[model samples]
Target: MSYEKRPDGRNFDELRPIEAKVGVIKNAVGSASFKIGKTWALAAVYGPRELHPKFLQDPAKGRLRCNYNMMPFSGTGDRIRPGGNRRAKEISMVTEKSLMPVLDLKNYPNTVVDVFIELPQTDAGSRCAGICAASMALADAGFVMKDLVSAVAVGRVDDKIVVDLDYQEEAYEDGPVADIPIAMLPRTKEVTLLQMDGEISKEQMAEALELAKKSVDEIYEFQKKALKEKYTGEQNE
Candidate 1:
């Protein structure tokens, strides 16, 4: 049974409705919130402050650290245990790497910039949402960056290539499913992160990349708008 119709009825190249905003957290140096469908991620940025361990400090550049956490009750499936898990650790590492290409921390030598991403509710795409939120929060914190990163999941859902896969598509049982999460520099179209969960053909990979690139462009617009609204004093949804 080849998957034909999307569970949510979105077009093959379509994404779930998205919402974004900056300055959502009061005490943090900077913060942003991003929501796509049922998935929601909040990111807070702190520091450019001194790195605590003396040996870990870099004389020429600052370091960026990211922590990703999904609240125990956040998932649409089973309850997640509170505290760090292997999945959280892996996602955290990837999220940091995804946002690193655009940032320039040279001036803030010996310091560390921390980004914390918390998902209060999710319906898949949590890691992508976290990366999106973290990027906005970093920009909001006045970090020097070449560009903002935008991320989304694009892959083969059974027989159809799709963008912004939801929970149902990821768990599609009738046929093969490939869930690929990609992060990119929208202005330059440079892929910073690409991870695939299932097998895909070369032709399918190329097609998926194309879809991801186009989708990130749309996500980029949302990110830019949110940042602009924050500084321009415009209300954002």
Candidate 2:
């Protein structure tokens, strides 16, 4: 089987059209929505506020907490409970790790930064889209950061490496391979989160990382454009 088969006639490194919006929710301190192909996610940021007594608090710097959940009808095949399960918890942790590196946590002491991600549609790259949305929401909240963070997923299908896998592609592909999801600080080109599933040769891994880095660069542009539009609207009023 050839992993290099092109779906939708896009090149190996090509990304689906990305649409992003900020401040979609009126109540949240900040919010953003992002779509990659059919996968859609909304992220909200609320805080640099007091932490609950039961939750762990950071003494030296503000704490970052993340929650990720999918709506019951998000996937095509079946509905899921609209709450955090083990997978959601793990994704949240990974997202937090991905975002922390870019945050200036010490700037806001004795507080907590809460990020929530809601997926209304599921595709292979939803996790990456969620991370991008969260980063934009934090920026909308007026949080200072070193640089914007963005994520993308690269997968091996039929012996070819592809960037931003869709649900259909991910499900049917076969091979000894790797699916690498990565978050990066765009300005500094620093990695904040990295996760991989399956096995690949060293050469293949290197190629995937190269593809991921390029994808991040593309995502950063989309993030900037989305942020500009949000603030532009506010300023015009």
Candidate 3:
């Protein structure tokens, strides 16, 4: 059977409903929660503090480190293993890279900024949600950033090209499935991270990227609004 409509009823170019908020973790220097459909990621930022182990400190600029982890029962598919794993490490690396372009760490030279992302629930798109949450947390930390980073997964499920593939779409077995996760800077529209799993033609890849570009705008707005709400609440108080 051909995949004509999304299992969730979203249009090919539509994204799942999103929610975001900053300063969700009071103890952290910065924190945020980002939710897209059933996936939820919480990020907390700390440091720009002096790096430990003098040999590892960068003289030219600060380093960004990201830690991503999914709770044991977070996924809809199967139980995630507790503690760090290869997948968590890989996503942590990519999340750091994706948020680096917009950060101005030069002033904090010889220091390190750490962002930790934890997914308590997921229905797919966990990495993208982690990136989105981390980006917001960084901004909430009052870091000098050129623009917010936004991300989403766009892919082909069966014969249909769709935006924000959920767990069901990712598991579709009838035909080919390609999952592409992309992160971009809002102001420049520059792609910071792009990764693809499965197979896609060059043309389909191009189209998927364009769709990701358009879709991230919405994610960016939610990020901005969340940051704004934090300050707005402070002012009202």
Best by TM-score: 1
Best by lDDT: 1
Model 1 lDDT at residue 139: 95
Per-residue lDDT tens digits for candidate 3, residues 97-182, read: 89998999999889999899999999989999999999899988999988999999999987777899999999889899999999
lDDT per residue for candidate 2 within 100-191, as digits (tens), equals 88888897677888998999998778889999999999999998877889999987776788898787777764555567788888777788
Go through the candidates in order and give each one's C-alpha lDDT: 0.94, 0.86, 0.91
Sorting all predicted structures by TM-score, with the top scorer first, yields 1, 3, 2
Clashing pairs in 3: none
Sort the candidates on lDDT, descending order.
Answer: 1, 3, 2
Separate clash counts for every candidate:
0, 5, 0
lDDT string, candidate 1, 1-237, tens digits: 777799998899999999999999989999999999999999999998999888999999999999999999998779999999999999999999999889999999999999999999999899999999999999999988999999999999887899999999999888899999999999999999999998799999999999999999999999999999987877743
Model 1 compared with the native: what TM-score? 0.97
Output the lDDT of residue 220, model 2: 94
Worst 10 residues of 3 by lDDT: 228-237
lDDT of 3 at 6: 82
In angstroms, the error of model 1 at 54 is 1.9
